[model samples]
Target: MSEFLIYEQQGPVVTLTMNQPEQRNPLTGNTAVAEFLAAIDRIDADNSVRCVILTANGPSFSAGGDLREMKRQSTPAVSEMDIRQEYRRGIQRLPLALFNLEVPVIAAVNGHAIGAGLDLACMCDLRIASDKAKFAESFVKVGIIPGDGGAWLLPRIIGLSRASELAFTGDTIDAQQALAWNLVSRVVPHAELMDAARELAGRITANAAHALRLTKRLIREGMHSRLDTVLELSSVFQAVSHKTPDHMEAVNAFLEKRKPQFGS
Candidate 1:
């Protein structure tokens, strides 16, 4: 519905493509952030939409931010308080929208993902990269920190040591290196990137939607939790999952020696 983002639905799979490729889909303005949050709201509120694939439509997935826009704002008299208050609302809400999506989000990294772009990909549950894709946490190079969740997401995706190395050095790594470092789930040829992403989404869509949602919630909350706390939380969600119709059908199908037919 919005020009800043394009939302497409095919069966149970949904795709949210960043449409401002000319500006490299920078997350600088209020419009882009609102459009992205709207996309997430659409995915979360639609029960028929079981999976999401995030991608862009140009040579670069995103160039982080509009350099010219930042340049225009840079001035000798600009106070720190003025800068923070100006963009604080947007910077705070964008990451929350990305992280709080109920359904699983897959990053279809098609090209260069630098600075905030890399952080956006890291927000997704899984990442599928095109052969031409390159990832970089270039915050340090620009005299800034990972303002958007890059500092938090990177270490969790890769190990602490590797994430530290990449963030500290601000090095650019190719798709293959990302796969090797476990940043992305897999890498496909450039021609097969979208197909591979769709295939993965399809596989996820074939399962019971309620179960998948609960599982996602479990994993997200369990990542930073202690063993005992996670165990308690797991039991809570698993009990709720067991009460779903699909769970009953799955049990009956197992007993009858046939495949479960999950409802949409």
Candidate 2:
């Protein structure tokens, strides 16, 4: 329904493609941010959608903030506090929404993911980059910090030392380097990016949808939770999963030596 994002659904998988290729799918201004949020809402409401793939249509995954929009907002009329409020209310929402969304998300980085673009990729539960893709924590190059929570997101994904290097340098790294740093889980030929992403998504979608969401929630919680806290949460989630009809189907299928028909 959004002009800036193309949302497509195929069975249990949803693909959110950033459609502003001419602009390199910049995550700035109102349209991009609103569209992304709306897409997340749709995904959350749909129980059938087991997985999401975040990708872009053009050569660049995203160029980050729209420079023209930034320039427009940087005027005598808008104070520093106003800009801070805009970031808090605007682009920052994408990371928060995606991070909290229960569904599993995989970022298919097809090209250059720069500045907040790289941060966007970090928001996903998994990342798959193309061989031609490039990544950069480039906010510093533009004389601004990562206003979209990259500072918090990047360190968690790649660790403090490596994240510090990227943040300080604002230099671009190739797909191989990103994989080496564990910024992305896998890298494939540019032509095979979508296929690889869908293949991974298929693997995930084969499981029970409710269980997948609960499992994803547990993983996210585990990141910041104590071992005991995670254990407790895991037990609760496991109990919930056990109650789902899909869980029964899985057990029966295993005993019968057949593939489970989840949500049946």
Candidate 3:
């Protein structure tokens, strides 16, 4: 595992914190992508993790690519093919891993999220930003494009019009603006961000775990599939869900007027 990430679990929830505070938690020039992939694989294998909270340990959520690393790679010795291979083997892998994760994920944005950082937040199913948080699709300002799948992720979250504006201008938007643009669901005081995230996770985990996973899958499928395709997938998943112990427990508890005690 990389020193850049801190992975911890509590009951049904897993928290992944980016810990490279002194360097602003950059995604490149480090082992962050590999660690994230490994941590995600571990979480997928663990049956109990129903929810995830993604946040950073310091002021900036992530500085996107490491500028120092970018400068180092800009030398004439680094060919176009080398850079292409670098991305395919590096930060580009994170979008597919995080987005395809089965459990629900919440990003608690504590501060600035720029370029790939903003794209990272978009990878989560939900986002809760601190009142102090700022976001920007800022690759243009750095004289580069978002080579980390920001082009696709940003437009999907905030729509093509808003995404286009941000990409073209590379201007920063604060928490309130982010909420207005639907980039983030809610904005809370910086001090209350983690509390808010935990409370939301609690609400999510109170239901049948199997049902939650099925529901998340349905939502993700709906994002890219046709209505008929999603409905077909939903039917099959629902059938599987109906046979689980937790589903039976949920139904019986409702009829008995008591709380459900679901199994893992």
| Backbone clash count for every predicted candidate, in the order shown | 0, 0, 0
Model 1 spans > 4 angstroms off: 76-78
For model 2, residues 25-136, the per-residue Cα lDDT tens digits are 9998649999889999999999999999999998999999999888978888889999988888999898899989999999999999999899999999999999999999
Per-residue lDDT of 1-264 in model 1, one digit per residue for the tens?
587788899999999898888888887853778888878887888888889999998988988866765665587677777667756767657777767777999999999999989988998999999999999999889778887778888999999999999999999999999999999989999999999999999899988988888788778877778988888988988888888899999999999999888887
lDDT of each: 0.87, 0.93, 0.92
TM-score of the candidate numbered 2? Answer: 0.98
Please tell me which model should have the higher lDDT, number 2 or number 3. 2
Q: With candidate 3 superimposed using the best TM-score fit, by how many Å does residue 199's alpha carbon deviate from the native? A: 0.1
User: Cα lDDT for residue 262, model 2?
Assistant: 84
RMSD of each: 1.6, 1.0, 1.0
Best model number under lDDT? 2
lDDT for model 2, please: 0.93
Residue 209 lDDT in candidate 1: 89
Q: Candidate 3 — what's its lDDT?
A: 0.92
lDDT of 3 by residue, 48-152 (tens): 999999999889998799998899789999998999999999988999888778889999999999888999999999999999999999999999998998898
